[model samples]
Target chain A: MGWFRKKEKPQEVVTEKKDLWTICPSCKAHVYKDEWDKNFSVCPQCNFHDKINWKERMDILLDPGTFREINDNVSTADPLEFKDSKGSYAEKAEATKVKTGMKEAVITGRGKIHGIRVVMAVMDFRFLGGSLASGTGEKILLASEYALRHKYPYIVVSASGGARMHEGIISLMQMAKTCAGVARLKKMGIPYISILTDPTTGGVSASFATMGDINIAEPKALIGFAGRRVIEETIKQKLPDDFQTAEYVLDHGFIDQIVNRKEMKNFLYKVLRYWKAK
Target chain B: MNLDFEKNAPEIEEKIAELTKQKATDPNAKVDDQIVGLKKELDKVLKEAYAHLTPWQTVQVARHPNRPLLRDYIAGMCGEFIELHGDRCFGDDKGIIGGFATIADSHVMIIGHQKGKNLEDNVKSNFGMATPEGYRKALRLMKLAEKFKIPIITFIDTPGAYPGADAEARGQAEAIARNLTEMSQLEVPVIVVVTGEGGSGGALGIGVGDVILMLSNSVYSVISPEGCASILWRDGSKAPEAAEALKITANSLFKLGIVDEIIPEPIGGAHRDYDGTLQAVKQALLKHLNILRRVSERKLVDRRFEKYCRIGRFKHR
Candidate 1:
């Protein structure tokens, strides 16, 4: 004797599929994809900055045709012979390369941002959630070394889930390795500006992401060392709505500032200009 | 309910316990012979079990609740220890304890991760999971050690860094990163010992050193065996198999040149003989310190950097 009852079926109406309209995760507003792109993937309704891939990030941040990539050929080898339920790490690497069209998760290069030449390393979260593999660490070190050698401002836009688990302890060593590179750059007095984008957590956040002299985050960017779910479960408490968000980090002083995607360029130029003047 | 190793020696343990209990209950009962015989049998069982322990079994022993924690080791080894608290950037984290201490007539800054002795202490210490504040506090102490030219000694024993949202918010990664960055070039000798579980970046937070020591029974890896098992097989029960494949035991790490020395534990485990283990660690520390202190400060820093730089190596062929 169940109280639940089957209800009458209503007539179905089919509407034309609209690929252009996408819903904002935060605001739940239907926004045109083109409009979102024009606004740098930041939802106009609620200013929720959507995660951007490295190529898109580069195009927006770097001057057109002025970017020169460094350490572009370094890719990860299946050092540990790691295999998982999905497949081997090598197979995943190949698949991720095809999907993301990049050899590694991080793209290290020298580029002009608002006429201020800087060495930049932009991470693509699409590739293995931007897990810092040995190659990623090598690339970051190379970028920092390049910045030090050329005396350019070093910038790294982080959007990673943290260390590459498949690579095992070899992946964990990157945290120390990259930090060592940053230490050298700092000792040489090179400016490092860490830009935290949406979904930067894990080993990536724990290491170089937070070591920036001038740490910046995009509006509503998710930046933290651990995942939200991991934290909530461990603490046995419900978290605040804004926890681990850019606004929350800014309030806590972990980051220097939170810039909207549109005005971030101007803010970088202003900071660069101040340093230049000094 | 029992340790994996204990379960392996259940018959011997039961006999020993029963005999010991009988002696305690009946004053006139001559159970000394039975207790001694059972103890001998238990020893033999322990030896056999430990000698042939699977990686998962080793993991269990490494995380045994009765294992002597950082506090016990510090109390036993260091003389005139004064605890310094707080990161100064945030509140003090009890997960990591550090202070000025004297060891073998040399003043050193000793730091380690403390997994509390009992349930209440464990809860309070976040089960040895360090937060950003803990790493920050460690960095503060390391910097202080550099200022006074005190040798840095860190006893590592954490599952990993705290993976909580608030910890991440406060910059757990950055804190660990900064420690790695700053400690690399500190103008003082840094010695690291893996007294227990050395899980991933949490251990590496203070891991960069002139000499890295690990207990024979300890295991270190990027991810825990259970974590690896879940990811690799979608089954946590596959941890035993995953542990075998991860090659995280002290012997494996030593063979891979990831660890400089392996401090042999007591016959059963460190937990069974705290004083013996402490004395052995102290001796190992003195031996390493005597050699490390002879190296010039610049050379020490260079070697430390070089040591980490050469950790992972493989041939294309």
Candidate 2:
């Protein structure tokens, strides 16, 4: 008799009592666990985007079983030992790992995209505010040197908020250091491709994002040096529609091309092939 | 809401309408000829008024909302531009836009300050104020140009590098200094053109060139007039007077031997005649490129260094 009663009340009816649904921060729509997972953490109803962690991005980007990260053991030091609302530099580093599951903001290594040899550097927005600190800058410089030494085409998948605020002046020096390295690579006649992902803003946009041999952006990515709101406030004026979108940038002649996620690997491979032929 | 023009336009229109009605009533009236003569006199007065413009007025012209920008020049002068981003170590800056484009059938690296056309674009470009990363990106692109043996052309138009807490934290001053040093030694012909306002270290960071050109109406100065006024006189209002004293106008700079040539603009201004301004720039670019092509890489670099080093010296009697 009890079994028959349980069968009469379905699992959906049982779950209805539990309220197992969460509203998405971006889209303001209710999302179930299965729906969120299936959509790759993207909102299914409105396509509201979220920042994906480094490891997940690597899995999506690199060839299967081909990502061998270099310099994972290296961590940031408090050369100045600065303090803030969160904690000291060292404490923040530890907290970043627990929160984002990545050791640093940038991960660098040699990887294959459709059997084309390339040195890759990716900025993880999850770790330490996705800012360019001394460690992050060092990682980029090291990656550039690696690409030049190995004679591999350099591909940087950037998604940083801006220059790292905590590391101060040292972080800023990284721009010059990394630029010098890139300069060397150019001297060697190696191709450097920069891929602008979602929310590639601030100091990062001003620098490496604008220095690529071929600059490519993701669809609907926000790419600019300063935030739109900041500029509006400063100028005390209204802005035009479609300002700083990948499409708008393409129209304004700021970016080379806007590529979609699914077709990125093939596009990169084609470019690499052409470069090698040249 | 009553617009500002509503207060003045109606009176002028009423007077004109009244005069026209009177002329229509008499076929042999001389009123029409008299009106035409008065209009000509007004036009002459307007020209006379503009002829003796103050330095502050020139500054206003430099910052004109409709003035030509880097995007405008690139579109008018080059073919198939390719933009590069980021300094790789930090982030990409919207202020200093640098990349590759083909000008006159030769591939060249082009760098310039991009002030957004509107509010949102300005913010996106930090109102054309570059950070350490922006200068670094320029350094990177300049090196790339050197490597490729392609000439580097810089269009300087910036108020200055960002003077914010974040910029300082990012070593804005140091990055600019490094660029100043590195660009001087770059083994390629670097041409700098002042299309608009060329302000201070931000302009100088990417401004080392074998031949520096200025637009007829553009202005280049060590410090902005307002800034200079604020520092020297403790008042921003004195900027116009300071502008004249500083000799920042293209004509002044050319007279001082600070710039090589002044590319003429269309009558009224570059804004009024965009195509004509572009043609002037195109011809000037070709002429300079031709001159630079004859010189060896070693000579180009040496001359660029010498040219910059010789700026701002006073002769002792």
Candidate 3:
């Protein structure tokens, strides 16, 4: 009991460890933050794709100095007026907005890939798990509309847990709303390329993100309809190590191609290269 | 059959059942007036209790074992039903079922999630939680209906798509995702009715239509109240609070314009009187099916897209 209770240790232990290091989450290899960031946060050892913000993804994918945002002012509205035990959804959303410096989970705009103008919607997972709220849906819908009118290839990079619960049924309807927007683009023969990033599941996976003419994914992304824990609980069994990974879904034929982080832009360019503006 | 809200109705009903039994046993025993009095009392209790029900109470009613199901509606409403099976690419999924049916003057292809009445049946149907194959089966039937130029009527009644390992391995997300786009493009009228638990994406797998009808007491939501509570408050016990706030009941969705019509359930609930619930739903299907029959196919598809396209509320300023 005494041995388990307490033990005194020497005080004032000094160490010269620098704080400017980025540890690879998978391989646990230490690398300089500058070097790691220069590689777009992909682990140099294991090549694990770290979750990147919308702006980081924008910089990595879009051509330099060609990005112009649309519906930037459109933002979240508490349709349910939802207040939980912690606090009201509005306050939480506001705090997330301030924390992420994002008006909404999805930032839709016109950008370029290999000098080809395209309408791209990049979702930021930092904004409430990148839940598809009403504002997110509106922005995506507006992006598709803009793409259709301008005859630009409508591309969206989805990184969301699912639909937002604060807005309740309205969030669920966004699934249908966003899908309808994509269906409109497909009908008009606009090139719609959907990119699935690190984590895409639930309503986001079950909507526009999976209906792209050429569905693409980042390497080893967690992509599925239900969460891993939920699947384990429901089936009452241990799942395989790679249950819903991008490679797993590719094997199952859900994803068209699993592109590496460095090669993503090149892959998109190659796919959309032949489709002239029409 | 006895809901927590239906306070004294069960006791009154028991008394009536007992008195009626005595009357049946012996003609000499005059228990008619006593039975009638007890019956009137039960009716009063039921009417008072159902007048104002909490959202949690409504969810209970919607999930009641005695609540009418897809099979019950098929038996009571459809003049003829030819049950279809298999998804062509994979095995048949009993979680969802579809077939050709005639309700009133309209001939339509009907699809719906099926929950079981007992444990064995529920297990067989995976408690109405569809796996990826279930959605694929539905999409196959939907495409068949389109090819035949028949209107599609879908019944949504599930906790959600199955959240299981096998479901994920077979690509549940893409199965539902593909259905949404395909259903939207179908050149035929589509009518959807949320008969019970319209849980999230699974419900929407077959939920899109020109007219969305929800039965009274049925709950439709982005996620189940319990699921929402666990995710938001980190406490599953707060489900009642979550249910109230989510406005999952049929009335709230109707007010929100998520649902087109609210087919009234019998006093107490659909579980109380199966025929009453069946008749209301039959009437709704008949009225809308005929009206849609008159609409041009091109206009129907366009209106369906527009209906879903304008479903969100946001700040634009």
Candidate 4:
């Protein structure tokens, strides 16, 4: 008798209008998340550059599904057993691992950029502020070694605060370790292009991040040897508004060129093509 | 003028000065016995204090105003020294001094972080902090040394590279990176000594070497304990605790396998006995150089690269 006279129609799918937006660091404009992601996290109105996570960074730089990560098993040793008022260094790293879903600050892999095979290491600023630790250094060195053996172009995109202080001297030595790794490629005349993003300072800035055959950076990226506040304190003078910007260093002859995020992949492809012999 | 751990040092020094002044005024002043006794007591005090120096105290000793510097070492060991200056791209950086010199009859390129002995000198050298040009000059000299088939010896004593606007504008990072990359394949034996404050990347700019030596009371840290405390604890007063945790002392660094050998200092520290410290450093240099001289140039470069390559303590799973 209750022959379903009227099955309730499926609820009409409501278009999600939830406010997901990115606040541009420079212009403070709220860009819709989808639009921002589509633009590689760049602001549409002000055209300000925003940092992307490692996954986004990889996807933006590499061919679809072509990345095979190398040295993925490397992890920190907590060499110092460092503990601070915040927490233990080992525990902090573990938490960062869970949060960032990354083993170390840097992720090294082999991938194709515009169908050109290359080995690359890209730093994730989300992971412990992209501080270089033993694991980061090891992964970079191993990747560089792989590139050297294969005679492939090596590229490193650096976005870091500096050395991870928890590892102490080991953290500082990562500079030397990574530089030696890069030097190997340099000695063999391999193309090493260093793409510096915003806020590349301190130990990383003073290491392989700067030692590139072609050093290019993003527009308005803060690239310098020391922190701006540190420089302000030491010099007892206020820095200009554009201090440490990529354009500023370019004017000073520290960097080669500034490439926009959208054009980065194409620019790298061109460089690889230039070095490649058909 | 501030002593971190040696208690009564300033007062004892003042008393010694007073007695010496009195003796000078009155040629027959009977203060010789007192002065000698006080000096003996002072030595005892220094020995006892230095024997138990915490890592923070060692840091202070490393940066002590009167600590013997590269100039003193040059006078003691580098015979027939001629300083080479200028990066040729910019003005000569006074923060680091490099030269061609004979060390025990071997012509080596001697480079070191130079601190001023006086106020004017400090101003000129920027308190031992280097500009980008300083590192560039060092690289220039190391290349020169390689061309001459000579070994390279560098002394690390800076608090750090200058964290200033001009330094950044001038490419401090690139300058240091050049040294790190070029030095690894320079085809010359490189010997490095941490004579004092081994400040972060600044010290490591010229720090790559076949053998790394550190003085007993010297410190090599990624950052000053004060800076660490401020960053981690939001309190600069916790510097002592930070120093302890950082393990910046030579013995600690040696235990961590970062420092190859620790050269012995005097009973107190390097500042207390400059000549003794310099002699010990000279002996260590000669000893290591003799060993390095026997190794082939290719082996030296490869070993140097491998030495730094295997430095980090980490795990791979």
Candidate 5:
């Protein structure tokens, strides 16, 4: 070790080049922060659509001056008191508000779409890890009950990552809860429609999303019960190009149609009229 | 090598392999004719074998990749679809899919499980395993249907609820139990179609209905053959034999009075002729819905409850 010791000569160091971030054409890169507000937080560059909260979606989808949200006071409790790296349910809920600006994962209420009375339940991915925990399950159950009582068509806009991690098994129970509620509605013989937006994955896909009397998907929506990566690992094979996309699902006969956002309301109007006639 | 005798064994396999290869190379290859011929041969063997399928074969058919899933039925049968999200509690589950749509002139609520066609989709949908939230979402949609006075339809195709650590932590068993209790008294005319594998509690989570219809090749069982084997023999390999004991095939279940009716599949299977399978499903659903329309709410609920209770009550004497 002593023999290998050598004197070092001083040398000039070169400065490392910084990465040049380009604005994505679809999702506008760094621009004036205020500019995003005008665009509804959608990327100004490439028109990449950012996830919107349930409230914003309601404002956009429902008829003006016809929305009346229900069960806003309901919240979750630490029944199991699950904890993880994300922190406890209490901490997560507070942080979620700061991050996603929502109180819960879903908002259920009565609303009118083109003057057709409907019960609406929209899930917001921003709150509580976008997971379906007991609170979300209960709210949906309540919404279904409301719809059944009022004889209104039920409409739900879905966007979720899966069951909530904090609530543990209670989150998983919602599958049965929601299914039972839907079963009750089925006995009542009312119309129910599910609009599958982007990234409708996990348990949500397994239960009501696939259960709709009419199942519609947004263009390019990623819809499946399991994630693509998980399936790949299980099957030990590469997936097809389209895989869970709306177009691919349509071709495979999973989705009835893939409608654009602009056409969704009109299409729904027609469906509602048909069902109402009968 | 006796070529003549050897030919029969490999013929179907060879044809399928050839067509698969051609399909890989040529996206537009019209192998439909070849596939049709092979399917006919396969169907003859299947009808002969399936008519006498052990519990395990039924399980395999129920889990077949080519089998028509709930999504497939909805796409083929309904005109428009609008998906609903979230259980309105903690989060939204992907295991269950529900919303509103139209069947001919009638507006209806539709719900079902969506198993993925490939790996990614399967994981996304949790292999069609419902969580508590999924059930809750179904509950939400059901209430909505009741409010609107629209009919409700459910297409069940799940192996079971997720048995993973996370799912158990989230209350899987209790949720399924609740569904069993609550669905019995729902006021709507609930129609359930077991389009594919209906495994245990997961299927039961959404299984209650005034009219329960099962596809020709579909199977509904308390537990999957592998699960049964694991419990009974402590070996997964014994699933074939265990399947024989389960008597889970649609025909067997129909005979046992577990299932209300068995909807016929196209010759061979649903995968061979998706359109034809859709037609059959549509006709069956319409027929059932028509009959259900005349039933009073109280009668429907009572009948549905009684139907499930009547299972496995045969005299032992």
Candidate 6:
């Protein structure tokens, strides 16, 4: 066994060299990839919550091996036969599926967080910019429905640019659809904890992302309905550097807390435990 | 209020303009034949143009300055209307108008985005770009409709919600979000009509309804084609292409099941025939309102919830 481990060092070093560096956007520091992953992708220098895909997010937040995905079978179709300069939405969807290894931008499922069962739907920014389309919205609604039916708490970690432009009005409709889902969950007395990760904007911010009973945002997350450029152009004024950041929103009383990445799971667990005790 | 592509119809529009000038100057230089000929040519050109309008053309038609605005809809369709103002949480927003009115003897609450008809009004109303107060004003009116058990009607026509820093500071996203949650649970028949540019959260802020309808030439999209183009292609001139991809036309929305019905426009589009457009809209609203009124509040809310929930769903193998 010792001789075999020694022989594997050369191959392991090659893999590490290929994947072991990430630049921190905040501090502009080169971070060791392994160290970053070990810290749940939070930059050790500036503590920036580096953008992560849904799978990584789920693994960080959910109890090990406890995620049972719901609405995984539901998918989107090219209903309008939408085509852009790049290609048809169908081709883009296929490409995104291969790139993200997920059927949709959002992954909805039930999972355990510190032994507390909760239904969660985490958005994947890598999948079509984490834009909310019809499928993404439907998955969220289905997740909430599952929570309401089975009496489980709900949590959603949102990271999106906005609504899916390729899906058009079908995407816009998701804003109302997801909100209606959240409303039902609330009516059934289920608690919803919405965690806004880095860059939650557009239609998503204006809907279920902001509809949570307890809206939690990651530190420095960008959360707003309009892009900064759009706002600047509309108002004809320069905005503050910190405008639309999670801290700014928190100062404005829009969100409840700005939880750090490393403590997010424990914080959620504590909240769920409190609800359970009540 | 000419469409941007009207410039391309020189044989029709330019000839008509020139012949009208000729007639005015000569008082009768055999201009009658030319006028009739141009008119016929114009009709043919219009038919061809309207038959296969690109998505961006539909967007232009929806935003045609002469298109009947919210005030026209209220004045023409409502038997009587009492205008309501203010969100109760902030100053009144002229961009959104709400009131109590009767449609075909059925008491209903009418709310809509007001882009304002003239230059002065347009500036005053911010081109129907709603502030957070506007959404809150809508919520207040919706709640009143629920309290009185009156059916609710909303006319969506906005480029988008206002994107000013002040609006954001006041929680524009939160205001729009609250409307979505509250409207879904409101115990009344809610009907939404995409009357013009139903853009993003601005539209969905009051867009959730038991039946989502659209005007024949209206557009409802998550973002303006120009914005989408600029974001995706880094050029606003690519808006025509973006519009095609966005699928914002009422007909496209109907095919996708996002729209419940499409109210036909007059031959030259709604702006050319305000009275005709108003009458058609009134009839459609009354018909849908009658059918929807038969439903109990619980069923209406349930169906409305289920209708939106099922919008983008599909079977994937």
Deviation of model 5 at B167, angstroms? 2.1
Local distance difference test scores for all models: 0.84, 0.72, 0.89, 0.89, 0.71, 0.89
A1-278: candidate 1 lDDT, tens digit per residue: 34343232221212223556878988899998789889888889998888888888888888899899987878876667777667688998999999888988999999898899999999998999998987888788879989999999999999998888877777887888788888888888889999999888878887889899899999878877766766788888888988888888888778999998888777887888877484
Misplaced by over 4 Å in model 3 are A1-19, A276-278
- Candidate 4's error at A26, in angstroms? 3.2
Off by over 4 Å in 2: A1-26, A29-39, A43-47, A85-87, B1-185, B188-317
| Candidate 6 residue-wise lDDT, A16-106, digit = tens | 8868897788898898888888988888998888899888899999999999988788776666677766767889899889877888889
DockQ metric for all predictions: 0.37, 0.01, 0.64, 0.71, 0.01, 0.73
Instruction: Give the candidate number with the greatest TM-score.
Output: 3
The docking category that best describes candidate 5 is incorrect
TM-score of chain A of each: 0.91, 0.84, 0.92, 0.92, 0.82, 0.93
**lDDT (10s digit) by residue, model 5, range A1-278:** 36444332122111111122323345447745456555554556655555677877787778988999898766665544434333455786767767765556889999888999999999987775456766777778779889999999898888887666444334544655676667667778878888887777666765566556787887667766555654565456777767677776566555678765656777888889988485
Error of 1 at A187 (Å): 1.3
Ten contiguous residues with the weakest lDDT in model 5 chain A: A9-18
Residues B1-317, candidate 1: write the lDDT tens digits. Answer: 37755655667767777877887898788988888877787788788778878778888889888888988988898887999999897798889989999986989999989998878988889889998888889989999999998899998899988888677667777788888889888999899999899988888998888888999999888888887788678898888877877778898778767788999998788988899999999999999888988899989877876766665433322
TM-scores for candidates 1 onward, in order: 0.89, 0.49, 0.95, 0.93, 0.50, 0.91
Model 3, residue B231: displacement in angstroms? 1.6
Instruction: For residues A1-278, write the lDDT of model 4, one tens digit per residue.
Output: 35573343223222233346667787988788889889998888877788888788889999999999998889877888999998899899999899988989999999999899899999999988899989989888999999999998998999999998899999999999999988899889889999999879889999999888899898888888888778888878888989888989899997888999999999999878888567
Q: In model 5, where do residues sit more than 4 Å from their true spots?
A: A1-278, B1-51, B314-317
Q: What is the iRMSD in Å for candidate 6?
A: 1.1
**How does model 4 score on DockQ?**
0.71
Real contacts recovered, all predictions: 0.56, 0.00, 0.80, 0.75, 0.01, 0.88
Q: What does the lDDT read for residue A35 in candidate 3?
A: 83
Better of 3 and 5 by lDDT: 3
- Checking candidate 3 for backbone clashes, the offending pairs are none
In model 1 chain B, the worst 10-residue window by lDDT is: B308-317
Model 4 chain B worst lDDT run, 10 consecutive residues: B308-317
